[model samples]
Target: MNKIERIRELVEELNKAAIAYYKYDSPIMTDKQYDDLYDELTSLEKETGYILTGSPTQKVQGDVVDNLEKVDHKYPMLSSNKTKDLDVVRIFISDKDAIQSWKLDGLTVVVEYRNGELYKAVTRGNGTVGEDVTHTFKHCVNLPVRLRKPVDITFRGECVIPWDTFERINFELLEPYSHPRNLAAGTLRQLDANIAIERKLEYYVFDIVDGFDSGNLIGDYAYASDLDMPVVEHCAVRDLGEDFNKFNPENFRLPVDGLIYRYDDTEYGKTLGTTSHHPLNMLALKWQDQLYETTLTDIEWNTSKTGLINPVAIFEPVDLDGAITTRATLHNVSYIEDLELGIGDSIMVYRANMVIPKVHENLTKSNTWELPDKCPCCGGEVKIHNENGSKTLHCCNDGCQAKLLSRLTHYVSKNALNIDGFSEATIEKFMELGWLSSLSDIYTLQDHKNEMKVLDGFGNKSTEKLLTAIEKSKTTTLGRYLYGLSIPLIGRTASKSIGKYFKGDYSKFIEALENAFDFSQLEDFGDTMNMNIHRWYVKYSNVEDAYIPKLLEFDTPKFDSIVDNSSDLSGKVFVVTGSLEHYSNREDLVAVIESLGGKVSGSVSAKTSYLINNDSLSNSSKNKKAKEMDVPIIMEKEFLHLIGN
Candidate 1:
């Protein structure tokens, strides 16, 4: 193809990929392939002296939508000039100290604090106008709703969902998010604050836009830290050569696109000025991905507890990032269709952010691969589910072995039944030996003890420990038992909320479930979650061999120590901040508050009855909110005294 034609084609392809990656939370192409194509487009544009108006290279800001109210930013939200070359970074930081931090791959938000309370949060739309997402951000983990100083300050930060939270959330969804950045963006723009809260979005302050007088970036970070602000992980680097390699994005728990280096001297950075697109003071360095070619051997479909079938690509082993890798996730049917994958096809793969193994390209376009029509584990009818324009495979059978195994594994997990010595692998082995087939089988493991001890990896000592742990687990509380059931949309938090709502009475919880009661009336319970809970109970409650009846035979002591329905603090919201002296830690204090029928919220708001801070006079955001809202600011000792402790 001619240069102009190829450039146009590349532009179209890159724009589609960007839209999929940023707007839809689904990536059709790998980062290496995109970068390679981008480089080719840049070269061709330079050679032809022609650039398309809609070229992806020319875009400075992300996609903007009308889902939320738009407001013009006081300071233009500029992008950072980026390069893959460390030499450019060295030149950019010449003789001055620089602050290097991860360029978090998430939505950029400008949060404004007025009179010590969060006034607004807006996205970076077209660098000038942005969407208002304050309501959604109010539930963001670690984000302060009130400032200690009551200062009117606007700061810039990245709203992100951590990798762990992203994985867990995606694990339950039929159409999983392709990347954390897109998920974070979508979650932040959600009209419902409860959705954002459930997803557990977090904000990390990276820059002070309108508050600080410090001429140094490090000083600004220190000032922000003093206000108990969640700041991005960063370090002062005097030598780029010595420290650049150490600031690897892979080490960060949050998803990061690259590393950012900016001159610490604020005045000098200002003197460098900025372009319409990017500031001259800051430079972003993206890692050059190393792609490896491998032969796809087969596709493995694994069924999850939600019945969603996930595709795993098994390929010839290849060393990647010092580990011998033989497989990578295909994500879903759409991903396979996009790649036109087939067995024995030569495909290119790379480790995303030097961590996740991903298929980048298909060198041989042999589109012979077909999705399984039957469930791989149970040979049941497999159905295709279309959700939000994404296709996913689901096992239609309720008795699918894989689903049962997953549910059983979840039931015995640390956050659920707290059963020790029972790994998923061991459970699978037990299932193979006919020792386990359902959740109730876990309690009756002793019946097969003599046989289990003779199996591989199981001996007298190990079997004894396993049996002891299982016996001990029989004394779990209602919250843990509910969590162990693997109810859809019912995680630890929801289980605890439900447990507390019913005062940890299993019979009351069962009665509510049977009566089809409106569980949304409970705090933090949404319609979808309530529906999931009722559906689960209705499906299994009547079964003669249901796990619930089997589990009820065990001891379930009342959770009286954790909650008291008659306390004066009942239904009141308290925000605890800073160090605590009356309690062992924040968790201990939170437990006490929850037990007293009080709710502990992360952020202070108008509904907050009190702000619990040892230093009540301190200028923290929670204290500021209390002062502004005329809420009581009480010390730990005073709070204890009020509770008659």
Candidate 2:
């Protein structure tokens, strides 16, 4: 294809992607893939000077949704010139002191504050025009409703849902969001402010567009901070390469796509002028998703407890983000068909958010891969289920052995019964041997002690160890046992909430069930959750020899004393990062905090009372965020002292 022809194709493709991302809240491609194509189009446009009518290079991306009121931006909110190379950043800085901050991956909003109160908030719909989202923006948790000095101001910041909130929301969603950015955008664009409040959206001011006159980026941050507003974490950097090398996105609990470098002198930056699409004074250093090409070896379909047969792609093992990853979830049947995946086809994979391994693209689309006709575990008939345009495979047989195996596995999981030596593999082995089927069968394992001792990889000592662990697990709390039951819509947190209501008394919980209690009345419980509980009870109670809780002893539950003013840690929120020396693990530390009436959040925010990290001076993301929010960073000893340990 010639340059002009390629430009038209690129323009159409990129435009479609933008619509899918901004309008539909769905992404057709990864950010890195989009950036690469955009760069190619940019180079083509520059070389030929033949930019198409609707080329992405000619305008800012995103569209103002139909329901929102379109308002022209007071000043153009242009995109920034971006690069994936460190050399480009080095050139951009060129011995000038730069203010570096995270380029947060979320929807950008231009908020205006007048007479010390928030007047309006608008999205960066296009460079010149935007949708007014003031209603939803008012619900942002960290938004400064009333400025300290009652000064008229306009600032630009990101409206984001923290990674933890995103994951929690996604867990309950059938068609989960692709990323936090999508969720944030959807939440803010909603006409109802209640949606934004429930999602717990946050705002971090990055730039003072008007009202506040700060000489540099640092002063701008200080001005925003003085108003009790959360600001983006930043630092003065002389060496771009050093800071970039030290940056690790994984350390941050919030979603950040890259880093930004802005000239410290606001006046000097304005003097540099602007391009049609980007400002010359500010540059973005995008962290490209590193893709590894690997050949697909096989596809595995695993039967979930819900009888949903989820597809997992097994590829030639490749190292991604310092880990050897061989498998990535295909998500559903639609994803498989979309990629036209096939065994032996070359595929590109990357670590999403620097954590979950994901298949980015299929280089060789053979389209030979076929859906499984039978369930892998029980050889039962499988059916394809289409829900809300997404297709998934499910086992038709209700009594599939895989389902029972999954339930038993959950029962013995660490957060459930805390039973050691009963790995999923071991549980499956026992099920095949006709020694395990239901949760109650676990208590009867001692009856086959002799047989277990002689089994492969099992000796007299190992048998005794497993038996002892099983006996110890019998003394677990009601919350753990409830979670182990694997009821629909009842997660660990919900189970704990229910358990707390009954004061950890199994008899009291059973009484509530018998009396047809309205579980929705409980905190955080909804009609769906309440209905799920009743439905699960009806089915489980009818099962012959269903899990007998009487066989186990329930310990008294420890409720968090959040409202108790006596405890020093009460009402305090802590975020733990890095390695633990005083505690066994991060979970253990979190437990201690909870027991002392404190809450532990996954990310640092304005609400966080303290950030616990041994390396206080470390450049970890959590430390930077805490410093930015002015939250106290405490050593383990300091934390212990604060709690009067």
Candidate 3:
């Protein structure tokens, strides 16, 4: 292709990849491939002195929407220049003292503090302007609302969701987020601050945009640290090789796209001029991906409990990041269309973040492909539904076996029934053996104890343990039973809300359902959720052979006695971290706090009244945030004393 044509093609490809990665949270191309093409385009722009308006080399910004107010940034958030070449990195540093940190793969946000309180939080949009997200960011996991020093300053950082929170949220979502970055971005832009808070988004300050100056970058970081600001992990590196070896992204809990290197001398670094797209003070280094060629065997459609059918690509086994990889997720119909994927086509695959196998490219673009018209598990009618400009396949049959199996699996999950020994695989085996069909069938497993004992991977002791667990589960609380029902959009938290609202009386819940009571009036409850509960009870209860009533007979539900709401800790939020000395465990401490009319949150925020940690002086993120917010940290004994225990 000619130079101009190549430039156009590169821009189109890179823009598409960026859209997928940033907007959709789904990536069609590997990071290495995109960087290589972007570098080539940069080289062309430099040689010909002709930059296309759409070229990614000029400027790349997040999507601008009308939902949030737009504000101009005091300092333009310029993109960092990146290189995978070690030689280039060496040349840039040139024996100068530098700080190296992870380039967290998430939304870049700038938070301004005025009079020791958070004034504004804005996204990095188009370098010059940004969307105001202060309201939502107030609930960010480690974001301190009040600083120790009454300083007027603006600092830049990345907002992200940790992998654990991402995974837990995805488990309850019908269409899971492709990456934590997208989840964090979507959460930050949410209209409801409660939703953002539930996702547990975190912010790590990286650079002082227009804040208190100490003449040196490291000195500024130390100042910020004294204020207990949550900062990105960084180290002074004299040798690149030693530092790079020590800095492994795999060991980090957060998602990191690359490594960032910045000069420690702030004034000296500022003397170096900047390009239109990037600053000379800092550079990013992305990992080179190792792609493996493989052949597509077939596409498998797995129908989830929500009826959404997901496509999994089965391919010839290839070693990737020390594991044998054979399958990768094709996010949606649009993804398949973009790749033009087909059975028997030559494809390239790679591992993302040294984990999670992904398809990079389809070398053989055989456009001939067919989507299954029937559900693979139950041969039910399949249909396509479009929402938010995305097309997704779904199974029309609600009673499909695949959906039932998924629901059954969730019903017995740890957060639900707390049923031990009955895993999804074991449930599948029981279903295949005709010993299980519905949720009620689980209670009757004792009848098939003999048959199960002789089955594969099961013996007398295993069967006895399973039956004992089932018997013990009959004493579950109302929240567990409600969560176990698998009501649409009703998760553990919502179930707890319902259980507490009705005071854990199954009869009261039934009365509310029969009377068509407005559940939306409750905090955090919506019309859809209310409708879902009503519809579910009506559908299942009217049947003569209903499982709800039968299951209720087995459960001995319990509720907490109403506590005086005038307690000192009432309505206060507490964050518990580290080991406890006075209590048996964290859960015991949380139970006590809840009984005293106080709330327990997984993350620390400005709303928190206290942080309960035995190690009050520990430098954990929660402890740091508590210290920054001026929230008192109390040991277990101190907490108990405050509660008058």
Candidate 2 segments exceeding 4 Å error: 292-343, 350-645
What's the TM-score of each model vs. the native?
A: 0.51, 0.50, 0.51
Superposition error at 224 for model 3 (Å): 15
Q: Which has the higher lDDT value, candidate number 2 or candidate number 3?
A: 2
lDDT (10s digit) by residue, model 3, range 85-164: 88888888888998999999888999999988898898886677777888899898786668989988888999999988
Error of 1 at 337 (Å): 1.8
**Best-performing candidate as measured by lDDT:** 2
| Candidate 1 Cα lDDT to native | 0.79
**Steric collisions counted per model:** 7, 0, 0
Question: Where does candidate 1 clash, by residue pair?
Answer: 116-147, 116-150, 146-621, 147-621, 148-619, 148-620, 215-266
Off by over 4 Å in 1: 1-214, 217-259, 263-284, 446-464, 520-526, 544-563, 568-645
Model 2: residue 603 alpha-carbon error in angstroms: 38
